[model samples]
Target: MRPPLAAVLGIDVGLLQSGMGGVAGAELACAVSNAGAAGCAGGYKLVGAPLSAMLDRLGTGTDRPVGINLIPEVVGAEELDHQLTQVLDETPPHVYVSLFGMPDDKVFDRVADAGRHLVVQVGTVEDGVRAAGLGAVVVAQGIEAGGHLLGTARRDELVAALRAELPDACIAASGGIGSPEEAARAVAAGADGVLLGTAFVVAHESRAHERFKALVTAAGESDTVITDVYEIGWPGRRHRVLATAVTADPDQPKKFIGKTVVEGKPYLVPRFSAAVPTEATTGRIEEMALYCGLSCSAIPAETSAADVVAGFAGVLPGSPAVTN
Candidate 1:
């Protein structure tokens, strides 16, 4: 039998790929889903045509379950509604919606009304209970998570707490989980599954820039630090990233450091921007926000997304072999 979380997600494995902005695009998402694990594409600040195009590609890429991640803190309510609307219209029923933070009742109701599955990543047990009550699967995010800091709790501890509070809920653990051993440890700690970001960041199908993948693969235990320096685009939020010269000094002059093309639209990346380096980004890549977790220490090289998922199948309880 599949694990509770995996069954809830309609996947063969309990492992989930994080919807990392600029990294987890359609190719990566399809690769993971084809491997029998749940996959997600980052829906960061995308609206209208770009969002619709991506959704269309994801809908056609794989028949397995997939999700689109949206951060409520990054986009306004009106924009989020628009994004959600387009997502519902453009994708099939199998494409679920995932939220990084706790969304308001209206947002939860919207997804529920559409009879679609909702996954909400939360930093606290209270939020997990609330999300479960709202009929959504809950992802317990720990402090070790890369990109954005959801809470200060440790991964195992948070998962344990959520389990204690809601025994029947489909709870997954996120943060600092890079290897098969770590995934097993999370399950031992009461998580129904594990969600990994750093491990997939180096996947060949990931859209992360080559330089970013190189840095993550070469990173050590102490290479990452949590800070708010790279918060121009999404300010006041702390995130864990590889220590760069820009992070070393927060007062550096704000300037355009790079350029990136998203959904065929080019945009200049300013210094301290929250934008991650992708294949479409160029110029001073190392100085930008290089989101990484302690899990980077385990990701030794770039590999296919299918291989990444296969690595964890053995460790995840009830996880089946990858069909691909």
Candidate 2:
């Protein structure tokens, strides 16, 4: 068996919440990290003064070590540079999970210079091995994962494959492992930890809309669809979302469907804007993107982030043979 993620991640628990864009903020991050799990801020497509301000707010809210996730390839060079500078300038997170692409030596060195762990999300064994060679931890993301998917393999298969390929590499499983039981199964299957996203989307501390939360709560495994329907800012990427009304309409224009003010500035909202809906989203509720995983079946109608973390800690893997 491998060492628990708590030892490797410097966090108290073996679970890590996904850095869900717009959904996870300081409030949710602080709550989860304080509960012993690693909390992460979604830093995708975010930059400039706004990014700095968000980090400042997160820093002020929690003294615990929190992480920030970035997809360098998805975000342009200018945006990536500005976002990195902003985070490094003020409060650099305790960990940096780079997804979609690998960061160059300079970026890796910068993260190490800030005394943070570099985590790379990989879908295949080749990528996992590559990331391990770069002295970075690997997150084995399966196809069942919500939002932006990484790999086409099943979660257990990916975790087992990654562990077999890199026995010494620290490996975590993300995707469909949602419940405490599933989390335990991943650990038993050779994963050092589990990264949960959909389960926590319904958490009280999450910044998602009430309607979105309700839809997730009522959704089942068959209710989700993975497509590039909402590819306004980030294109050619497949994201798993609920089969809402907008997804049914193929000819929906890529215009601002709604308008909301951010930091006292009004911004036009596009399809899948990565901007979480609020009371101000004056548009068709079911027409917007609703990202979720098949694991939504295990989420309760209402639960606290602390409670969710604690619940996972109490669960024990059923049996090695069963989990395997």
Candidate 3:
């Protein structure tokens, strides 16, 4: 009685971890996958050597099926094509690609042609149907999700709508889902599985900044806000983040507030940049964009990714309770 997505992805449970940039790295993804759930590494604008190295690490880290998240809006067509090509060529057949926004038909065709699985996270029923029509496992993302939002629908509503439209499609719910009870609610609303971002942000293996983890663990239900203020790198997309001083008044001075290193390269993080604070970041970390979701209330402290996966495994349909 396992969820359809679990069977499709060859995992024991239907739970999937978000490919949170800066936070979800090889360690976190491997930990989650090892715990009988699906895990995905964030591929935020990564290309060339960095992307290749990441895929190599993931391939060697765990034999379990893992995913690489790529956003279509972040990179141009040429770079995205390169990323997809590298992913399909360099990784084994078990590795799949997950996209944040609706990709063109060519992207879908490329993955199908390569015989690799593709998962698309969409924010609307129409997008879900389209993705499903193109032979992708659909992940319906609500506005409550962290990072860049896809649409303005609520988690349950979108899940139900997608289910009604595509009865046989593998639909996973994302956003505002932290606790096992909340995951159950999503299932009750017709989701075959649940995808979590905020809960994984506080995982012990996450690469998020220590202060950022602490702030998320201490956040309340009402401490999150959806804003488009931090849009320097990836613009025009709204994201849910913790209520910070910068968010309170977004008109602050446009100066470099921090620095982060990704794949051996260093980049200066300017004020209102969409970069999340990672362990490699140094500067006014407090003023940077701290992406968080309403599910922060369920993240009490940093724990192992296995425990986070175990907590949600039991809530999935027909999945046995997993122990960390």
| Best lDDT among the predictions, by candidate number | 1
- Per-residue C-alpha lDDT of model 2 across residues 133-243, encoded as one tens digit per residue: 777778888888888776678888989998888888788888876687788778778888788888888899987778888998998889999887787767777788888
Candidate 3 wrongly placed segments (more than 4 Å) = 1-3, 321-324
Error of 2 at 273 (Å): 4.7
Error of 3 at 11 (Å): 0.2
Write down the TM-score of every candidate: 0.97, 0.90, 0.97
Comparing candidate 2 with candidate 3, which one achieves the higher lDDT? 3
lDDT value, candidate 2, whole model: 0.75
Model 3: per-residue Cα lDDT over 14-129, one tens digit each = 88899988888878888889998889999988889998989899888889989899988889777889999899989988788999898789999999999888999999989999
Question: Residue 271 deviation, candidate 3, in Å?
Answer: 0.3
10 residues in a row with least lDDT, candidate 1: 315-324
What's the lDDT of the predicted structure labeled candidate 1? 0.89
lDDT tens readout by residue for model 1, 1-324? 324677787788888889988899988998899998989999999999899889988999999999899998889788888999998888999898999998888999999898788999999888889998998888999988889988889999999999888878888899999888888789889888889999999999999999999999999869999999988889888999999999898899999989999999999999999999999999999999999998998989999999998888877655665232
Model 2 segments more than 4 A misplaced: 92-101, 262-264, 271-280, 316-324
